[model samples]
Target: MAIKMGTGDLAKYPFLNEAGDYLRQSGFDWEELDRPDTREILERAEERLRTAVAGNVYEKLDRYETEILTFVVTLIMVKSIGLDPVLKKYALAEARRAEKFLSEDLRRQSDAQRRALFIKIFEDLFGLKIDVTEDGRLFKVRVTDYLRRSSHFHEQEWKMINRLVQAGQVFLDADETVRLIRNELAILIINKVRGMSLPTLPNSLVERVEQMRAELTPRFEYRTQVVTEYPPCIKHALDVMNRGENLPHSARLMLATYMLAIGKPVDTIVEIFKNAPDFNERITRYQVEHLAGSKGSRTKYSVPSCEKLRAENLCFATAECDGIVNPLQFGKKRANKK
Candidate 1:
């Protein structure tokens, strides 16, 4: 059996060249000669249009198709403006990427599709925003309407502008195109912002995003810093636990009291309850607020309060002197590290 391959010299054809007709209708001034790259670009672009045509007429799409449309426009631009050799010989198939964002009922697309495609081609790829002119009189065009109705472009008008953008990317850093391309993106977004939902963000979202990128991306440097998190109340309770060599749940309450007495927030005291079997912020607050004064008898001026602080005689002295420092301050203070 012989295999069939499709290769034929087609200077002669049974049908007229469809691409040639569209070019003529659009008013392009070409040499009337077939160039290889131009033919390829146009053929591919028409194919994209054909694919679009076959989908459901009433279907609606919210796809971000900016890249696909941009690719096609780049093709046209390259032919109009000529190639740039600065791209190394080992470069990939294409030096730039483009897309067109649009949403619409597919059934009515035929009426305004061309104009929509044109506007996106020029505005999105060139970094131009859809806004009033500097004079403040021109009304901004909606990208969605223009895309659905094909309103921004007319038949044959976009070919030159498409070429200009493509030519620039081929010779310059393709990533730079992102800046030029997104200028108009916000205009389309403002209409939908209120109803938009985005992925979850962090408390320091912007900085965290930068941090992650810096750590994960190629050629980024990273640094480390130490931070002190302990406060005076916490430190006092912690010291008690450490002195005993082992802190228990009863002892934890003592730490909580210390924290409360020093005016630590109830929520902060609650946070210290990792091992607190019966931790309650309200109870801890009550206990820490008032230290027993002289066992209900001695006043500050009546007896030798702190100066005559006898270890065995006083009932309201430090826990080391037998006052029982809350009950949990018995074990070693737990170590925490960053």
Candidate 2:
């Protein structure tokens, strides 16, 4: 496959030529591009688009050279034309390539500079939440809208912002994006803040997106954070629940008892059981509430001990769990020291 450019190319198809030129200058391998397996290339290309949307754009482009810019443009273009899966697959490959260049350019910046750019981009995408004391407005409506929409913020992207909250760190069983959104909502709680300051993308990257708009047009499933601190028994239960598998009576009791101990609300705990095949909200609520001490003896239940769990065939020990008797104490060994 060969790439054609210049005035004749411009006349044939209009796109951001400058961006294309930059990519063309970098070059690609012709032999690799000349593949006999069109099906494999198409499948891989589609995989690239899915990966790009999920924030793996840079990693996916470690090999491909021709498909990057074209992918982004194609993705935008497909948003208008009804998306054919074939077009979408090719577009995804292109996006990976474009993102590779963007990532490299970003990598060159000083750490602080890069952070400032990310903050700016986030603010531009989602405006600051105004403080009540500062001449107030319909901020609630604005915040509601933001929370309703999806954000580009990912869990891995929160390292810097997480540091700003405190010198020390605390881990919660929620996504970093969820934590960031909650931070934004903190204004409602504190009633003293003006807004959250998140990093934004660099101007060059933003410019590329804007250029696409002027030129053409286009465009979890519960994705909570992995609770690494969870005990093997609890982890097994959660994994089973996620897969729509049933938990035995004892297993359900253990999970409910543990989640309640961790301070998860009754309603939230109820939602967790909603994925079960025999899920009944009324029954789940009664059972959860009963375990939480609202019924019978009014005594909140506790998670089973490792020995008990082992007897029940629910225990699946990890190397970290050795010497721990109680599931509650599994990940807290270090915290217990502090």
Candidate 3:
């Protein structure tokens, strides 16, 4: 594959990693697939869509690029009949790409190859797995057989198969799979560009992407005010973790669970821990997902109480910590006061 540098206004996006640039240069852009960017794109798309209640200005974007823009807006933007034309247009385009990508050899390809390709494209574009459902027994069994024979299979892959037991079956045929994957890629690309303000582009062109982004992105109030509500112990743990200090397992769990309980998205929680002394994206994602009830027992963890933190010697009491047992209680008290 040819490796190309990031281009257009996407290179300026604040949260994109070097990997995203590399992938884009290689002709597959998975930009804005991260939690922050995805949220931003959704926000922008929503705002732009609302402003243009009448019609879009319709700048001429590349067919593939436009399809991606349209998908992100339609998918993330609020669910309404207003976006049906844009959604159908890009969805059909993505479907065509999916058909071409799958070709006639889909049946002939080994299940392992199919599984591998499916996983790679999804991960490459969205940094996410296409969840396998209980209905996908044939697909799951084939993938499991392949993993059993492959030494490269690790705990993450193992967990994916486990998740397959519960996820909804979305892949009906090879073409459908391709179409879905392509649609996601389009969203990823749009997320990268539209999530970040388009620098140096003509207002008309930028508006086009933003309009699409607005259509797909949803509206939500910013949670910036939540910082003041953090309990002293959880706040301390976060500060120490951010400084690359080694935290006890209990401390880590408390922080992770506390953040999750506060309605912080999994991605945001994971990003907060990225600065920890031993941060591994795969391991971190698995652990966070596990705590957030996306994996394993599906039981969302609660933050440890003052008593538990004291037991672990992870407690850092301050004036704000007075009489507080659990972090959630602390937050609730503050909210109730307001």
Candidate 4:
């Protein structure tokens, strides 16, 4: 049976097709947004962008129509600004917001509603179906679909070999299922926003758009020269990220710490990760900054030792690495010899 989403559901998930239908039914006019009466809509749209850029979740409004309209307006503003980082940031934030609500609904809603929402979000939107286990404590997805979605996750727990698979299905809990859907939602929003081509914005939105561009534009000084001294493991990590593949979490930590150890700017390291399929600029920036000792603990991180890397299956050591215990020591002896 098809699930019918009400205005409340659409408000919580404005990226849904039903939300678009709601907008069309409401006869929302872009021009009408210029009037003072619609100022709240514009303000909420700006707030959405501001929160997204700040790496925080935007609070949904009390009225469902207003929430839906602000989402559309937010997209228009993001499109108008024409910044890839901002677009990605906004999409990720929106996806996370939806994920939060979905988690709440899955936990609190009646059994029938929860199941319906699960099917509506996963099967209807993402074309991936999940079945509840006989005990009803876990969900099961086909191995094919599981691999397709889980590939985006860098955590070891999400790895197929670590999962419990029976026959053709892989088991997941409600939280895990929702987590996978979050990635799908983010990608869906990113593609949708990228494909939009907006006309000239009304005068009311022009100033706010300029403000967003000024605030969100990255302005860090970074080295342009390519460093050829990267060790094999670092090179492999870079290659994986540059190829838009998911780098394992441990490898990613090793790569970031190694780059920081070699004096790479946080912005530069963050830029390198832009090619990653699951890159979220806000999270990347935060993690890179944390490793750089600019955030948290205030203690800079160091590259993992070669022994640890080997244990993690991240080492690609050659004869050149014979004397080095840490990645930072890779070219030390060679450089000293020269």
Candidate 5:
């Protein structure tokens, strides 16, 4: 038998089966969403959508039931709006929110409880089994499972070669384990939302859905034209992002820095990321500005050298890249020849 989660647990992770069971057992009907008594739920749902749009976590209500219901209503609202970007954004935000609570839960539980909870959560929710080392200081996951989940991570540190593995199992600390599952959780939520069949929303809820659509829609005016002067690596990164695929963090940093080095406006660089699968305008804008030296440390960052990029597997070197140590130097020789 699977370990059952309490209402509080369900509230933290409303995507759990227990939360869905709870809502169904409560006899809550879709028509009730427009009732005056359910206005609080509707309002909370709207707030959840807005918070996600702004790239922030939605706060949980004092009542666990309210939290669970609000999550359901939020999903209904997101599904009714039927915008792909909004669905992706909400799924990402909800997953992050769950991660925050999960991290807190793991830290607060005693060692024995933490181990059991961690194992149970992974096994039950993700069908992935996790084990604690004999000393209980490290978590162990099968190499195959690690490879599947770690594919979502683009950092060099997540590469299998960099991991501590023995006897077909990869070793990771508690925090790292949690971080590895964040994308899985997001994907799960997205799948669930996509599978839902929502009824025609009441007028009140329809109006709110329209409001959410207006707010979450991308309104960027910048059109991306291929800059022939850009090196292959930068162009590849832009192509990945334009196709709405996830770009590796190193590539994103390189692209941002290289663009900034060539005097591209911060807004233009930020707009370039609008088509990213996980794009959050607020977070992207902040990061682009930071790279531009307008935020944190206020020190302009430079594009990584070709050698560093190659080491990180981010390089797409061609004959044109010859003798160019950094991406900024890619088109210089050609310009000089002209």
Candidate 6:
């Protein structure tokens, strides 16, 4: 049976390795249907991994890069909703705590030493001078400008970067060396970028990496502030995971929304009901009702009006609906729609 995962495990622990070995060594059937790389059109993963490995790509990454990749996808969850601790702080603080869970060599490294190592490794990655602040441990660096100016908005790239960071961190914990992890980082970075069929690496990408490296300038900046953390989508996934439904959370939620929005209440109900043999009508009704709350449960339930949508921060839906004058916004058409 699969083990239950909680927020702490999902966020703190990595979901990697072991599977390939199990599949090869123990005769486990690999699910070909599931894929880590979604951008198949841009880059076929098999071709890239081979080339990246040949380049001696896996050895030279710095701590930060590896840490980022291992834990990158979590940012999506974080961005979708708010994070429990605003990331800038957690990034620095947890770097230490995570080590116990990190290394197979857990006998050594007391908490004090770990904290010191956290500060040292963090600073080394993207250099920043640190100071303890009244609110919490703070590091002064321009994350705002970084976030705005950076091209990291793309989900695919975000996953790649985070994966590298995680790997580098693990290597650092195992070995007491503070060497640049560029090669190890290259393994991930090259593989991910290779996934793309971009004709060339934009000069701008190189420049931005350089600029960020400068800002990190011999130190990583960490701070605790009221920050907008997590994405709406990721938060939704966590919420759904808590429900423990057999269907993937994302699939179920998307289906629920499209079904409700397009005027197929019974079909949605029948579908979800069938899936959720343990379905709770009250819970289902609560979710549907709470959304566009005033509307009753009916075929023509009131789609939120333009003004209502705007006031309620529904611009994304609001814009789509404007054109929707909603044609074929229903039943069978949906399977063929998106």
lDDT of 1 by residue, 1-338 (tens): 12121111001110113323433455643332134434543444333322322211111122222223223232332222221210110011121111221222111234344233324433543333343223322223343323333222223322234322221222112222222332233222222222334423223323333443343234111111111243333344454333322233333434444455445665554444322212234554444333222223332112122322222222233333233243223222332211
TM-score of each: 0.15, 0.34, 0.33, 0.80, 0.87, 0.24
Q: Which has the greatest TM-score?
A: 5
lDDT of 2: 0.47
TM-score of 5: 0.87
User: lDDT tens string, model 3, 186-214?
Assistant: 35443443454322433333444566556
RMSD of 6: 20.5
Residue-by-residue lDDT tens digits, candidate 6, 70-184: 2332222222222222222222223333433434222254554433433543343334222222332221223332233222222332222442232112111232221122222
Select the stronger candidate by lDDT from 4 and 5: 5
Residues 27-113, model 4: lDDT tens digits: 877788789999999999998888876657887659988888899999999888887666766787898889888877876777678
lDDT of 4 at 293: 90
The worst-scoring run of ten residues by lDDT in candidate 6 lies at 52-61
Pick by TM-score: 1 or 5, better one: 5
**Segments of candidate 1 deviating more than 4 angstroms:** 1-111, 123-202, 217-338
Each candidate structure's count of clashing pairs? 23, 16, 13, 0, 0, 51
lDDT of 2 at 270: 88
Query: How high is the lDDT of residue 158 in model 2?
Result: 31
Stretches off by above 4 angstroms in model 2 are 1-225, 336-338
Ranking by lDDT: 5, 4, 3, 2, 6, 1
Assess candidate 4 and give its TM-score to the true structure. Answer: 0.80
Q: Where is the poorest 10-residue window by lDDT in model 1?
A: 6-15
Ranked by TM-score from best down, the candidates are 5, 4, 2, 3, 6, 1
**209, model 5: CA deviation in Å?**
0.7
Best by lDDT: 5
